[model samples]
Target: MTYFNDFDINENIKKAIKEMGFEEPSPIQEKAIPEILSGRDLIGQAQTGTGKTAAFGIPLINQITTAPHVQTIILTPTRELAIQVSGELQKLSKYMKIRTLPIYGGQSIGHQIRALKQGVQIVIGTPGRIQDHLRRKTLRLDKVRAVVLDEADEMLDMGFIDDIENILKQVNTDRKTLLFSATMPPAIRKLSRRYMNSPVTVSINKSEVTAPSIDQVYFKVLERNKQESLCRILDSKDPELGIIFCRTKKGVAELTEALQARGYLADGLHGDLTQSQRDAVMKKFRDSSIEFLVATDVAARGIDVNDVSHVINYDIPQDPESYVHRIGRTGRAGKSGEALTLVTPREMKHLRSIEAEIKMAIPSHAVPSIEEVVEKQQQSWKNLITDQLNDDEDLSLFNALTEELLEQYEAKDIVRSLMKLNFSSAIGESDDGYNFGETGGAKGMIRFFINVGRNVNMSPKVLIEEISNAVGIPGKAVGRIDIFENFTFVEVPEDVAPFVYEALRYSRINGARVNLEPAKPRPKRENRPRPARPSR
Candidate 1:
């Protein structure tokens, strides 16, 4: 329970920490910060979400002067990590005027070179990009006073060991090195032995499971049945808010589409989305406008919503560390959460690896049956009716009709007919059809691609509002929304798709011209053609 003030933290850093709402140091931060400040090379073994970024960032900022040359270089495994770490460092150094830049791929190399030429004091970069800069002679490490290897093991797994070693060799040998990793595998140890000076090691909270408050379970099914299995699980659990993790961007997009077709309120997030699109998705999730968010591991890292009730692994992570991070999204702040993984028979070995890494076994869960789903749906329907009855709505108009019907028909028959109709509309189709994996929705909804998205400040709400106003369709009937960088995809009733398409053919968003067309199936990697450059 050591507070930031307990240490000799700089006043500006303390102010920033307070603004960030950090009341106390995490175990890793408390233990590693002091060692790092003492000018000692250190090895920190802690999983994600342990506040490791601040553990190194604070001391690094404190030790660095406003020198023009690069004084600290941090290497990460992914662009997301690079950006995340760089952001944290910028906040920590906000009042100190220390320049922090994140260098990674998927951005303009020219821009990065220009930034480096302007003399950034701290560079947080992926190993490949850092190597690229070093080879291009655009970056010099001659004055580097500290080097940090964030998620060292992940870099090793990604085959960046050589890049790491080469970067280390270029730095001054006497510079303090800080290595933080979730696990110290043999390769990681070898890395430490070869590069780090006699380093003090800090291990935080000794639990094998990163998320001890999560209930972990897995379901075994055919790979092709994953979508159906997910639906049954969703119907059974009905989490207030949940996250579904897919392995690839394409997987994320496909699962999101499939779920929406099944009438689930869901959306997808991945790197292909513009920042505005990502922000809009997150805002909807936080506001409960969307009940489920399907995303890839990299895309999900920025999610910080507190009430995530469940984390569903649509694909098993290839490595144990990723599994820990995925499930760790829930069960936060000591709240009880659920983690469910859908596993195919072929992926049992991968599951075993995850179990061993966490030092526990995940119990097998049966796929919820058709009867179970029907019962769950029925109960939900009853709850909805009860809620409506409790509402302050005038029912005098319905009372006369009810009385007339009661006089001619048995009350049981009348109630049964109403229940049947309610269930039919609520569940969209019969339980038998759902159990057999028949997709449900408007039955004739067609998806169309619109060449306007969040880049033009488009959101699901705004898009629906515009379409309904322009095409004279109710906003509620507007189907799933998937917005990308420069375009959008929307579903509407097939009968009216043509009408809506024609209506929006000359639409514009944010003063930009709009294009409407039927959505072509996204091409797979092998068959996809090279994209033409966007017009200026």
Candidate 2:
């Protein structure tokens, strides 16, 4: 289908599509929608950012022209995706009086029960949460006319396959079933054979799994310098909108703080935050109030945002499938995007695995030096000046001042002075004032006190690994580890102290309860000469 208007949809659906500014249908939508509207069981294999939501949502909403009732159920792998699908369905049905309710964990069940009592035509939810409602008899699906399994492969990885089967058994067997996944793994194939009745398979091209317009590259850096490398990359690229992926919640928080401290507009999103907080953070990201959004993979599911110029992988994903999902957030629609990944020397094997999975070689690049960063900044400044000059504006009031400045000093000198004044505010001082401390000793480190100590046979190595896993920091960044009778004290770089404190506050060491707090300052100890730490 070249355009949504080419499809035989009612005026209400056309009106909604027009309102949403969707001119032409995507490849998946162009193929899947027609088959679905004709009552065929459909299976769509496409990436996340390929307009898959609207492809299924539009037809599903178009079929719902009756009163509010339980008719359609869309199962997602995560609560975030459930909410996202429900919102899109609601928007697509704006001209038509369709009601949708999203059921998921982390929200009040009482409110959901009340909404169900009032009535809902479509229910979008996670398999676990939906099963909970079914067991409680608060949700019934006997009248469901259609079922959708979105991101079926992800649900399998998350161990929701059993729950999905149970949920499917409750619905009518003659109903329509639509399954969508980025890959057609064996598990997905088996599930389709068991559930779907001769489903029509619609897959986007294999080469289309990742956007061709995206410039994908990786940066090789030492484990301890990941933060510094990310900062330098941002300074050089100067992305208009960017998202940084962290593997852990604590990492997201820490990296967001690090970027903000460096004067970048950034925010963090993770599972630890409440639903309202997640919503607020996403709203800011969508509205362009925040330039950088650091998030974990699970928390970022179902997030569809255009205008994202870059996606930075602060940590490599667990698998290549996940890499596709992360980079898909950018280069959406027909626009270009850039994806950069930071890899430690030890993680090169994992990088190679990702490349094999994607069936493409991601070239490695050296980290930008200070001189190169300075040159890029100067070019950016020149581009900014050129854009300002090209923009239409009345400059009559500044003509007199320009003439007076030209007479008082050389024009080149005057221009140079103006450039210095304007550019200084954009690029701050170099990172020469920060101290990273010694790797194995407590030179410029902050001591954190923990409850579990010598009684539990806790060693420095174990403590280091625990802290690194909990906070998503490299073990090399951790300093000395000292243990006492019932308490332990560990040293971390001064910059990472806050992140470690916050992560350890809710974490345990060696399966023992822990209460972590900042330790009192200790006297310096004599040690051999070591390299001075870098400045912030």
Best of the candidates, TM-score: 2
TM-score of each: 0.62, 0.67
Q: Kindly list the per-residue Cα lDDT of model 2 for residues 400-492, writing each as its tens digit.
A: 999999899998999888986776534444552224243333666777778777777788888888767544569988987767767777888
Q: How accurate is candidate 2 locally (lDDT)?
A: 0.83
Candidate 2's displacement at residue 220, Å, is: 3.4
Tens digits of per-residue lDDT for model 1 on 1-536?
Answer: 69998888789999998887787887788999899999999999987767788999999899888878999999998776787788888888778878999998778899999999988899999988899999999999989999999988778877899999999999977699999997789999998998888999998753433556788998765554568778888888999999999999999999999888777899999989986788788889989999999998777753556689899998998788788777777876457789999876446667777778678778887778767878888867788889989999998989989999999999999988888775543344322211211122335677777887767877888888767755445899899887876778788876556456655666676677898777765534535323345589
lDDT, model 1, position 398 = 92
Clashing pairs in 1: none
TM-score for candidate 2, please give it: 0.67
Candidate number with greatest lDDT: 2
Write down the lDDT of every candidate, Cα atoms only. 0.81, 0.83
Model 1, global lDDT: 0.81
